[model samples]
Target: MPLAEIPLCVWRKRGQDFVFQGQAIRYWVAGQGEPLLLIHGFPTASWDWHYLWQPLAQRYRVIACDMLGFGDSAKPLNHAYSLLEQADLQQALLAHLGVDQPLHLLAHDYGDSVAQELLARHYEAGVEIASCVFLNGGLFPETHRPVLTQKLLLSPLGWMIGRAFSREGLVKSFRQIFGPHTRPSESELDDFWSLIDSHHGPRIMHKLIGYIPERRVQRERWVSAMQRGDIALRVIDGEVDPISGGHMVERYRQLIPSPDTVLLPGIGHYPQIEAPMQVLTHYLTFRDDLVSPPRKAACS
Candidate 1:
């Protein structure tokens, strides 16, 4: 008997090519109900949500798109990529998709920062975000431990590093963030490498990583939105992730008011890939709790 192909291949086939800012943005929309937008992290694309797409789509309209410089999207040279620009791309894409109502947000990695920006917009009544669930990500830069490659990417030598970076180096760095038990399989890693290598994606590493410092500069604004907003918010973390694991969760609890957190031991940065069901459970619980009417007090 022959082995079956990876599940993400199905998504690749289902994805539609959409236009955003004259760039061909790769996107997938499935299921039907309240919109649940899945925002992916840095260096990876919407495929990060492949594991949970079908299951989550069962109950809600699930939408995901590759940010301008990622996945099957256009990767332009010498272009500046900022979190604000990423956020703008998100808004445009949603409007194009006819998402007029507020959206439920599930974000990971760099996408978490983008979500924070959207949260701020909601705070000002510029946009509406129904709720948000943050996965393993650098919500707090102080708590974030950027790998050496990330540091290099943010430095003046970043361009040279991006140009010289090899697939093996990327794989090694990627594996370093996963827990020992949940490292991605070889085929999965190959898929990631292929996405990054597409349209010379690696060359834009420095630009995309500019979000790190932007997080620090905009901390007060983004954090304030999460703390003061009416939306129900949750943070689910992979405890063993070296990047933003337990330590980030600690900061989140200390800083965010009435913090709701789920800690998964032995998992890593990519919880969706490592522990898909657990992530889905937490997500659905949060979504359901928000939708369910408040419990009425029993008669005294």
Candidate 2:
């Protein structure tokens, strides 16, 4: 594929490499300041942040990695792709980099689950964390509405279905989740498929999709971490996403005390991609508010 045709060409050139637990991990680091670790959702790599990478890197020390079984990372057929292990890998990655500064987290889809485990660790083992921002994901299993492809991928014939998946299938599936009006462009679809095709991603998608079920099993611990409310947390979602959009936000507001959220009315699941400026503005506002919270008036 021509570099001009695939946007990932530049992202590939700019990214650095790391080895985690004997597995090759693709991660990127840029800028300087407080560390902001980005965890991308399933079926896509850290490239998901490509839209917001430079602007974010301009301010914060940004770290993003392609988790195991996704993107440029090695996708092993034997390993069980679980969120717990993914969280462990993230911690190890930061630790390996000697990132001791208080860290902020930005996660989407599967990354959200891993972030939840990290949040739990903050309470359990005292990992320094300042805040966490969640994108559209199956955070609550009940609220997650997987499209037909995902359901089929999780079925008994999942492995077969995943292996036989095609580019047309990918486009069809994405169209369902993304807002009707904000559908992915041809180039965007090309990038997504190309990334998935890297390292036999399609072959192992079933294993990765298992996170949905894993979320239900570990619900007690992960959900408790959110309910604990120890650190600053916020949610930015695309309201039209069929999977985890407005519906998920409603559930979040109901569950988390004093919830802070932003809903992009016409947007869908991938808010960062669909509306980078909007997501960036809202995200910066959330980060800024943390630094200088609005003060209350003194009693007369």
Candidate 3:
């Protein structure tokens, strides 16, 4: 599939861009009400949220961006990608959108870590995150199971391995993560492969995988943000996911105070795509709970 002809590109019409530090950053916005920022995972761009964008947009002003190095955003070769850098880019995006009011957040995979960094800024820099919900992601490196290709791409010879990365590997790795019942179609795979290979992105895959180590090194800072109570937070997980699904949820329950988790059995890593309606239901339920009044104490 040609990048421009992908489903997300064709369906989406409100796309826009802004230059940040001399690089063009692409973002999409639609709908109205309180702004809801959606951050996509690693190896993909804002298009990952395509399934949830319209529905959620009907209820909230939806905003999503192709974080630098992915999708329509500028991919600068030899540039280092980090959670903090992405978070900063997010900040810039919000600023460009003129979103000064408090906003809700929904993130998945690499995007979850980016959300954590933004949450931390909520404390350190007073960036108001009204609420947050995390989908399958490696919040705790210990629970993360990176595929063999991921390990190789992050290895010492990663530079060479990244150059040699193929569409076959992309299909195999992506397919293996989804549940047998909810695997993405060939069209979806083609779009994904096209996005990754766009603008010579595959050549820099190794550099993008750098987040695997950055996660461990910055664990204290990010995990602390997840554990804090200043902001309401919830986690929706795909139980069958081998990467950051069941195991990551287990760690979340163990560490987060008053943790809220939704388990989707038989589902895999990308619940937002594989089980979007279910994910949307859980998301709205979480948001409603955050705003709903607590029940009055029973008369004694």
Candidate 4:
């Protein structure tokens, strides 16, 4: 599918739009071969894939979109942001692009929730997904350890906390989850703050964070998606993350059959950003295994 030009053009830097339910969200598509969809975490835009985008594009038709209410997309204050809607948005984007072929998914954090929802839908008659690769995320709500700030934001007075949210608070929260050796630098933190500065904090954060609790309510559907063997699965995680670190990986091994996992010891949350090359290696290895011919026994 053409990445641009119906009413707007799509570019790596100046991305174009795809309207979903009348809301225009930014999306980027590049390269060729089977499609590979990238879904980013909460409070961060699709720019999270910048580190690995070009390299990945070399092998597959890489597609990424800034979900509604995130990035440069229209973040209406009245918008009802939920993982269900986000999953629907992804399916719609593929359909709009006329992608009938089985595609792949690479998702992180909140995007994990969206991916799980899509995986559940995979058992139905719809867009066929070849496989999925997960980064650090709360696949199991029981294991997720939201920081104090996140907990406060989900509280009754979250609006008040949101009003008081500051860059310092964000920095502190980020540093907490990130590995001690891999903290966000000033410039990087600035870019992150800028993206969410307006939409982040305030009631917008409160609304967006609703996904945390929703995870609990729909825990069965999502967690079960992982166990169903519906699609090939791989998890590349930052083991040190206080949120869903190595512990989550252990849980996955216990639940998923013959789980495929890559554990980055020093990395924290944001593996693609912190350890781009490593994440790329593990991801490509997994995808390659999917298409490669199985090795046969030597002739006697």
Candidate 4: the clashing residue pairs are: none
Give the alpha carbon lDDT tens digit for every residue of 14-48 in model 3: 67889877899888998999999999997888778
Error of 3 at 52 (Å): 0.8
Top candidate on TM-score is 2
Which has the better lDDT: candidate 1, or candidate 3?
A: 1
TM-score of each: 0.94, 0.94, 0.94, 0.91
Displacement of residue 200 (Cα, Å) in model 4 is 6.8
TM-score of 1: 0.94
Q: Candidate 4, which ten residues in sequence have the lowest lDDT sum?
A: 1-10
Candidate 3 segments whose C-alpha is farther than 4 A from its true place = 1-6, 11-13, 293-300
The models' CA-based lDDT, in order, is: 0.86, 0.86, 0.84, 0.82
Residue 59, model 4, lDDT:
92
Write model 4 residue lDDT over 186-210, tens digit each, in one string. 8778777766764443447778889
Residues 69-108 of candidate 1 have per-residue lDDT tens digits of: 9988999887878898888888888998999888889999
What candidate 1 gets wrong by more than 4 Å, as runs, is 1-6, 292-300
